[model samples]
Target: MHSPEIDNMAKLWDLIGDIRLAMFTTRHHNGHLHSRPMTTQNSRADHDTKLWFFMSRHGSPVAELTGEASVNVAYANPGKDTYVSVSGNATVVDDVAKKRQLWSKSAEAWFPGGPTDPDLALVRVDITHAHFWDVHENKLVQLFEMGKAAVTGHPAPKLGRQGEVRMA
Candidate 1:
């Protein structure tokens, strides 16, 4: 039998495994939330509690992470009706080996100087909690369910699997 923790982690991974980009949100010094699209660097890995990204040291995200470690990364695959939101603490890691390991030729477009570039920054987010929604049925079925619930004056039928996983 699988532990509940393992099941939760597996479910979380199943929701986000194929999504490459996420909206990484952080709080700025002025007390405002900011979000930006970031390509996930470690999604293919088996690790369930950490997410990685390559960024510019001079960017606002790096500065924000320095000020406040709390952050949220959201992943959505509308085609598959899957969405995930992950909360974590973010930190800038100054590990060259890790940078090299996650490095890709496509990254050169942003950091022209490659992994050894002084401006390149590696950010790691230690996931604390994750919430996910995955709809297994087709759109037509979902619409039918909603319509039926509305006509019956009952709560909408559960159209998907939704759960939360605490990792910290």
Candidate 2:
């Protein structure tokens, strides 16, 4: 469980845990942002404030991050009105042990040769900052708030809790 006073990374983990797919964005050589869906591998954020993903050694994500480490990963749970965006530096790790630790049978679908697959790449994103919005209120209440704000000509009322975490 996560509490208000819990470590921000843990709070981030709470928002994203069940939202398994994230739009992992990275910069391309031409300076445009590129994004692709990647599976979230961990059940919780570790104290080190890192997020992990497995990629193919031949994949663009591995090559792009190698050339430019900056990246953003976005997770959204529309049903829960929870969204999280993480900004970080990414590096392709060469640790076999770490790869083995994070590996799963599902991953074999991508890297058919298992953990020892020569094409399997382990990526570690060292979180520098994160922002999240979690709306616990029901849709009816949210609609009412927006309506009231529009009638009053004021900014939309805050829909729910918003927070930022800086780890760098």
Candidate 3:
């Protein structure tokens, strides 16, 4: 069996590799969570981080961020049986240079006018922490815990506490 730390890291790596889309949740002015589907723009292994999207200077999401920067981003891959939720603060970046760097042909499908569109805005969420559950592996772990419980009469391992990390 792998050490807990190694197993957790492997799960996280697998989760990111398997998930291609993420749902971004931001707080509306009235305090309800507003969620929208966002394509996974990029993932940086060095930081164990991922970036989701937005049109640079417009949308209710950008406006909401101006007032409250806290947000939640989630990813799921049913085929891989993995899920992740990241909580962090988002900042609006209008750097033309960054816009140029991240621009791609695929983005044109949504933003017809391209990256130069005046309304295009970027919301960069610097992930502060995250929680993940790998149902594929956790199921086996759960079975083990259940068998142990039947023999020793102890409670099974708690559900949904598979792996997590806090950014420094």
Candidate 4:
């Protein structure tokens, strides 16, 4: 069993694990933003939150990020009613050793050439800050607060957006 605080942190980690798909958005030179769903190659928590994703070096996203490092990563799990959005700078890494360490069979699906593929690229998102709302408990809390406010003729406090609210 975990303490209340630990339990909450564990829940957040679970939510992130449940949703492996991330919508990565990047800005183009022309000032237009592009968003695409990319398979989360791997997600591990280190001293800092690091998300690894695989993409072709020649892909449009890669080209866009080369010029502009800003990006937004959004994840959603409808069945679990969880969502996470992370905003950070994307850095393109083509280190063969690092790619080998992160490579897996699933990645082979996209990169037939494996980690040695000259076109393979890794984008690492260094999350600065994140916010999350657990609908499971938040919905109940909201109802309770609303009822109390109704009886006391007071307004309920505003809640931030669901998932990781990144301000960068």
Sorting all predicted structures by lDDT, with the top scorer first, yields 1, 2, 4, 3
Q: Model 1 clash tally?
A: 0
TM-score (C-alpha, index-matched) for candidate 4? 0.73
Candidate 3 steric clashes: 6
lDDT of 4: 0.74
lDDT of 2 by residue, 1-168 (tens): 664435776677777778879999999988899999998676443445888898989989998997899999999999999999999999988889888878888898999998889999889999888999899899999999899888999988677899897776
Sort by TM-score, top down from the best: 1, 2, 3, 4
**Candidate 2, position 34, lDDT:** 99
Q: Which ten residues in a row have the lowest lDDT in candidate 2?
A: 40-49
Tens digit of per-residue lDDT, candidate 1, span 61-143: 99998899999999999999999999999999999998888888888899999999999999999988998888999999999
What lDDT score is found at residue 66 in candidate 2? 74
Scored by Cα lDDT, where does model 2 land?
0.86
lDDT of 4 by residue, 43-158 (tens): 46421356778999989999998899878887887655567766778899867877888888888988999999888998887665555654565667768888989999999776
Error of 1 at 98 (Å): 0.4
Using lDDT as the measure, the top candidate is 1
Over 4 Å off in model 1, which ranges? 1-3
Instruction: Itemize residue pairs with steric clashes in candidate 3.
Output: 55-121, 56-120, 56-121, 56-122, 57-120, 57-121
Ten-residue stretch with the least lDDT total in model 1? 41-50
- Residues 1-168, candidate 3, lDDT per residue (tens digit)? 776555545555566755657888889999899998876555454324435465546588888898899999898876656688888898887666666666778877877777777777766887767798766545676688789999998887665546686663
Deviating ranges (above 4 Å) for candidate 4: 1-12, 43-48, 137-168
Q: What is the TM-score of each candidate against the true structure?
A: 0.93, 0.90, 0.74, 0.73
Q: How many clashes show up in model 4?
A: 0
